[model samples]
Target: MRGDGARAWLDEGLKLLAEQGAPAVTLERLCERMGMSKGAFYHHFGSMPKFRTRLLAHFEAEYTTAIIDAVEGAGGLTARERLERVVAEAVKDTGPGLEIAMRAWAKQDPEAAAVQERVDATRIGYLRGLCEEAGHATPSRMATLLYLALIGGAHLMPPLPPAEMREMYGVLLPLLD
Candidate 1:
């Protein structure tokens, strides 16, 4: 269990992630931002890699839980509809820039990559369950394609009107049917 100070450090670290890209987040930067010395930094995390790993783990847990909850709350809804809702909520919740930062950090950090893999696996599993529930065939392939489309599309999506965000769901939702 982490004490208040440690949790504070983690909170500040995540805030930095939200404010700036991952590359710009450094131990020195955190120290300066938190108004702490090197000792305080090392007290919470032994090294930069360790801190980065924890940060990714923290983000993964929070994000995956949100996705799962969104899907689960769509009880009795069609799989496609549940998935579309998840995509929309995920985008609004995570914001475009933070999602990009996560992808960028995951690309460069093994620990972050591991968290990404776990999150992806969980998403794929959720889609598989949805397919099963809907009596759809080829759950694995469908899950893979669904995740790829949504995640990849979210990354590359250009600026859109608020209406377009919800409207895009209508366009893509049919593919799952």
Candidate 2:
């Protein structure tokens, strides 16, 4: 097994989750993908529950916290500029099948549902901050609409083409300005 067996397991778990949904994220499945044994898996995670908890944490860090950090540290940008950049980046980074898989997993697992709740709150809260900074009359309402437009739009049928989505954001940007 690799030295960072835990990370490797988590990576495989994420891949399985994205490709085959959370039900496929079994220890057996992960070990099979990693070419490792149960012993190796046990060495990294004490139990399946522990592994699931850590996997959710890893997802939150990779998906939500990292994006927030990047947007906050972007230099020489106004609040609107930062918001635009975030929307543009989000349009490009769809997380492939991961978001859909997670949403489905949350429906069945309360633990996953709680994590999803926190992730949504963090993202929406950040948008609200941007709206407040830009002096929107109804920051909360604008933030909700903006977040729904970006996140909800991601799961739309025949998915929104990136160019058209960018155009939509372009139109919305002036409203925030």
Candidate 3:
């Protein structure tokens, strides 16, 4: 409870979710992982519902908003260039594990499903804009395909390596052009 306990809970919860899925994200599990107690969690989150909501927000901030901000803030990058950079960065980020877990959680939890829907839409929207900038024949369709491929790859047994992912993007570039 001394320093940013709420963030600690969120971070641990995300780890549990990634490793063991949403069902493992209970307060007991998080507290055990953090070596804290229920009182400490209650001090920050008040209740399970509050904790769940904040956890989702934290995931969105860390996984989606941060990446978007980073891509947008990179000076002189064209939309296509930005898109490539975002995908490359994602290949290195641990957020994909959380994403894959969240997708599984979405099937049983409406709130998780709603958050997943919004996240997917926001990402696809950005992809669509980039596709339009790159002059893809059908930006919407192309964006959907690209997003699906990325999401589908996240579910792979070993996940795609960064080099292989870059190669995939290379193969995708001419199609976008």
Candidate 4:
């Protein structure tokens, strides 16, 4: 396919995936959305698996640079401020159902699982670095626990009121100190 065609397909595919999840990103649907032929799809992606690979790469790049960067940028701030900011930032996905959908898909798809493994490793590494910067011992283990807790809290505590969340952070932050 032409460069413009490839770009259009990828953009449309990602939008469809984010809004409706992976199952909604069928070749037929993409072709219909882009008003293109199946030949165009094959020309760029070769196959659905190839397209999925590209999509994952795009996701990794965007999430790391945007959300993760925002989280890590908290480094110069107090640890408590950092954690609260990270918590709020990580959970603030803009209609990209892809993150949660990808997590669910990881349970059954080896490729998805691999993507998640990379994401986890990156998150742990960031947290570990932060803990070290704070002069904390056992940084790796602490990073793991903190990373897991943040993810768990984000999902499980949906009704987490703002003031209560702040209070919870107040309780946990000193533990890190």
Q: Which candidate gets the maximum TM-score versus the true structure?
A: 3
How does residue 58 of candidate 3 score in lDDT? 88
lDDT of 3 by residue, 36-102 (tens): 8889999999999899998888888888888888998998998789878887876775646787899
lDDT of 4 at 61: 69
- How far residue 94's Cα lies from its native spot in candidate 3, in Å, is 1.8
Better candidate by lDDT, 1 or 3: 3
**Tens-digit lDDT track of model 4 for 23-134:** 7889888888887888989998899889988877777766655666776665667655665676555545443355566677678788978987898888788777767776
- Which stretches in model 1 have alpha-carbon errors above 4 Å? 1-4, 69-85, 157-163
Model 4 vs. true fold: TM: 0.69
- Report the alpha-carbon TM-score of model 2 versus the true structure: 0.89
lDDT of 2 at 153: 64
- Top candidate when judged by lDDT against the true structure: 2
Scored against the true structure, residue 18 in model 4 reaches a CA lDDT of: 65
Judged by whole-model lDDT over C-alpha atoms, candidate 1 comes out at: 0.71
Residue pairs with clashing backbones, model 3: none
What's the TM-score of each model vs. the native?
0.74, 0.89, 0.92, 0.69
Candidate 1, residues 119-138, lDDT tens digits: the string is: 88887898788766666677
> What order do candidates take by lDDT, descending?
2, 3, 1, 4
| Local lDDT at 103 for model 2 | 88
